[model samples]
Target: MSDTEGVEAEVAGAEAYAEAVDVLGPFNGPVLLAPVTHNPNNGVTDGVWDVTAGDRAAVLKVLTRSKGTTGHWAASDDPRHWNYWRREADVHVSGLAQLWRPYGIRAPRLLACVERPDGDVALWLERVRGGPGTRWTVRQHVEHLRRLGVAQGAVGETADRPWLSRRFLREYIAGMTPGQELLDDDEAWRQPLVREHFPAGLRHDMVRLHHDRDWFLQIMESLPRAFCHLDMWPANVRSDGPGSALFDWAFAGDGALGEDLGNYLPDSVFDLFVPAARLPRYAAAAYEAYLHGLRESGWKGDEHLVRLAVCASAVKYDWLTGMMLARAGEAQVDYGGDRPVSPELRYRERGSTLAFLAGWASEARDLAPRLGFPEAPSGR
Candidate 1:
């Protein structure tokens, strides 16, 4: 068969396997049977099956070639991208599992990595025992933040690929800004929302941000590097009680220690439907808990600097928000999951939330002296 035909056949085989597993039980009896759904909303690449047969329960994730590389898959063209994708999948599952198991951080236990006859990959994992019981409470979310902090600290210096280092974020921000016009033209659907939140003046600067790589690199070198989940939002985080399980580690890499902390605080606060007024209190507590975990994990640095680095990371997201908004008119906005991209659903409705974070940053700045950090630096 030609390579194209071979890949097509592989895709068909994967689908057939999924169907057979759902109808029957395990193929060989030791395995389980379950129906898997393709998560199109996120990336639409893989099918996620909720597999259960008696005491052994797991999620069987089947992947053929991806429509693109928001997640892991072999691209027939580029050998490097192919290697990077596969290496990442194997390393992330095994590495984080090894790192977190000792510290009691919850993650799916990796069962097996099955390479298909036609060069596709399937990852079988122990399913999370129980998902968060209801909508997460504010306190529960705060505790989850603390746990994430512990996990981050525990992940210190484990994987040291410099390409995934501080420079990666810096360069990414620089590259995306100039492409704003293309994004705006291609992704016009987001214009209303982007224009509503972002002023005209700032929008121009969005494109010019490509010129300011120096600031990004300066910030990068100053920040202490730690192992980051790189995708630590509420969705990837599952919880029961104060305990939580973190999944989806395709982007796991070394990053500034507080990157995930800043990412988590806003996500947990917003997604849990926490009251606006109470957000500050919860944030402060999560920040404190995260610092404590970092200290416990043997980090030797000025804690205040780390906090500032975390805040600046928010600026990175601010840049990303503009980019996504610019592309809102595109056929799909890639949110980097198993599903196809959709609208900026979370940020669209939560203007108040972003305002809250800005306010929290201002307050945090005022309290910086008392907290042993200098006043917030000024720049756009």
Candidate 2:
């Protein structure tokens, strides 16, 4: 059989079905498997399927290191790489995902972690039926951020794990080959969304931000560190009853105390889940709530320091505007789907987010000196 046919046969085999049923509980009826659409950019994921046997359900995520194609952001064999192929499996097996239950955050329960003869790992996880983050209210977003702060604060110092990602932001940013030329292309900025949302001042700020990316990375290195869910964005989170459950632990590691909040705020609007106009209000409230949670967890650090880190964390997206400009002429697709979306809508939403992040970049520069980093980096 061909490779594709072989994979299909393995996935449909009775042995795998029985294993899933064993962990998912005995079923009185036949088992069914349906493929689920997930992020396809990650090369490690062989497939993801929703497994159903009678009333029981589970998600079977097959991870393999054999994929031939490799995007710049694709999974790496290096254990400390930001997108390590086996990180999520290690996270579930080590019970790290359950450590934050007291802080009102958790990961989906692991039903089984099966190692296959073909050098793949099949992660059987409880199918959480929570509401998608796109449907979450502003209050829900704030609460989730606060909970994340509490959890990170409680961790104090992360244990030295060989597999934990190091220099994640720096390395991940370096991987992206952004279209730097588009930053100065006047015509690129003339696109409808860019013209309306990104003014000349914002454009200038974004360009400077891209140039000073290393400066912000240096500043983050000087700040207090904590265990962080480095990829805590809307699409990776879900409302689990009254609390939240985060998925995709591929980038979990040490980071600046408030770095997760920084990622969360901009990402909420990046895909238009939250309106761009409400960003300031959300940022203000979420920052305060996160601070409160940190304090409640016995953290007594300087709030200004956290604010600076949050603002400077905008450096993480320094390449995004350039990438958007390069793609501005192309037809847009909905996030994680093949469905076509209006280019105008896509650019308008994402451009507004870029403008907002540019403001944060400026704030980071201003805040840096006050935090005692008086010598600005070469780009500034």
The number of residue pairs in model 2 that clash at the backbone is: 0
Each prediction's Cα lDDT score?
0.53, 0.80
Worst 10 residues of 2 by lDDT: 1-10
Error of 1 at 318 (Å): 3.2
TM-score of 1: 0.67
lDDT of candidate 1 over 1-380, digit per residue (tens): 00011121112244445544654445453343444422343332355566544454566665455546442222322222212334334554555544665554666667767776766667776677545412566666667766666666766667554223334455445534533455345345336656564433444343333233354445544577876666566566556334777765655666777877777766654443455456668778878887877677666677876676665554454455454464545654222232353344443433445555555344444554565444444535
TM-score of 2: 0.92
Which parts of model 2 have CA positions greater than 4 angstroms off? Answer: 1-15, 377-380
Global local distance difference test of model 1: 0.53
Backbone N/Cα/C clashes per model: 14, 0
Models 1 onward score TM values of 0.67, 0.92
> What residue runs in model 1 are displaced by over 4 Å at the alpha carbon?
1-45, 53-56, 63-84, 159-168, 171-179, 182-214, 240-242, 269-278, 298-300, 323-349, 356-380
